[model samples]
Target chain A: MDMAFDALSDASDEALLVLYGNGDPAAARSLTLRMGPLAFRVAMRMLGDRAEAEDLAQEAMLRLWKIAPEWRQGEAKVSTWLYRVVTNLATDRLRRRRGVGLDDAPEVADGAASAVERMIDADRAAALQLALDQLPARQRQAVILRHLEGLANPEIAAAMEIGVEAVESLTARGKRALAALLEGRREELGYGHD
Target chain B: MVMTDEKAKGLALDDFFAAARSDLPEPSGVFLARVLEDAEAVQAGFAAVPTAPPRAGLFARFADLVGGWPALGGMVTATLAGAWIGFVGVDRIDTISGAYFASAETLGTVNLLPDGDLLALAAE
Candidate 1:
């Protein structure tokens, strides 16, 4: 097991995907560890539901597993590819929601934080997620990928399958919309106290 | 007061965004297991290694060559076997008899049978 971990540590995601295609269980485990949370968080933030996010994460990972054999080395980062999958899947679900929004609060695990800090973080994340859900799907995706996921415009563009200019436009508009939605809720969100 | 309040609001928003991103949610063990299961299911169906049985017949070998569909491979093997038995098998029989004819004169010269007797046996 340690040897498998060692073999996986230095390997690139593409190489790990190749290993996975060849039925290396360690590669799948490594990919799940490395990419699962990212997919989960993106889906959770985008959809504002834990169960749906988990489903999307599973679907995206399943697609990755299916495509591993044909995955082109160095053509794309595995994370980026999963991001694209999650984005598309989340977007499809959003469309199917038809504006009947599901306002389920996101599930956040606060490891090592105090009770008060966890409450504060959870409240703030809930507020941000509410604001995020109010934005258009494309704009919401762009903002989540940019601000929360910390992805660059080009990567966001690739994930969303849009032009870089479109990514910038969507993110700018989305942030402005978020600010508008979140502006007066400072006190309610515990931001005024801070 | 308004300018100060605006600056505070901006700072608060920044803080909010920061706090929102600070801690990501950990996927539950069940969720991770499901993802792993998905990977397992997909990997099972994927041909990680070529499926060639070394001692398999021509059709099975061909099927393995073309990506290991046993039914299709079996059909191909049957077709090749039929062609070989029907055409090449007859040709081989004719060649064996032709060799017998080519050596007949030398063998018959030993008078194992009289000329007319040999002719009658050859006709038979």
Candidate 2:
């Protein structure tokens, strides 16, 4: 059975999950509406492919559903859990690409984004993505979770399943690597004026 | 922890991080629909029902194991007969199952209850 959305709108994500666990279909819908896009965005940024990211997002949400019945509240935010799951899934996919095309990331459909769209969005965003694609998976995860996702070092540490010190070290190294990669594109990416 | 959280607020000092935040993609409506579909599908399994009744209890299971109440009644009747014979002594057991011993000349059978007296009593 389902509860009214108006009544559940103010409920926290964890509360919605509990309601979903209690067999409320509307709670699942509410959770999907609230957290699905965040999961999709994280997956997209990690995988750089729309379709794959969507699949990963759906997979991660399925995990969320399966865990709802036993979810221990007050442990962590649902977003933090999604960050961990999506990065782990994306990292697995990236690892499989090791021998195949690790050195040469071919242009997928997401890579074929029009220059107008790229311009409409920030050039630095695209440049950062391209540079991020070069770092090893762990470094990319650390950097993305730290910088772009705006997670604190400890939260990134939790998501990456590493020590806080490791997170800091990885983030620092990743930043330096990204800087080196983006150095060549400074003029085009709107950094030359500085 | 408070120090770290405070430090975190000062994050994205880099211009690149700001740009990436601004360029966050809006999830396509189609993808949102697919996610909703997935959620509903998962929840359907959670909420769907066999509508099954409660499981049979031990006595009911034993009753079935013994071939229903009719068989149970037959077993009960045999038990009462055995108890009556045990109270009266093995020599008072019915001759139907006493064939081997009754064949001996030394052992003879007689009715424990007099048929004629019971008939006479009933008629009176």
DockQ of every candidate: 0.44, 0.31
TM-score on 0 to 1 scale for chain A of candidate 2: 0.86
What's each prediction's clash count? 0, 0
Q: Which segments of candidate 1 are over 4 A away from where they belong?
A: A101-119, A191-194, B1-10, B47-124
Best by TM-score: 1
Lowest summed lDDT across 10 adjacent residues in model 2 chain B is found at B4-13
**Candidate 1 TM-score over all chains jointly:** 0.70
List per-candidate RMSD values in Å.
Answer: 10.4, 10.2
Query: What local distance difference test score does each model get?
Result: 0.78, 0.78
lDDT of 2 by residue, B48-116 (tens): 745588899998888899999899889999999878877987565545446755553222445556799
- In terms of docking quality, model 2 is acceptable
Model 2 complex DockQ against the native: 0.31
Candidate 2 C-alpha lDDT tens digits along A1-194 = 34488888999988999998888878877898888888888888888778988888889988988888789999988889889998999999989877755358542234333442344336667667777787888999998898888899999989988899999999988887777776655545443332
lDDT of 2: 0.78
True contacts kept of each: 0.66, 0.66
Candidate 2 chain A lDDT trough over 10 residues, lowest sum: A107-116
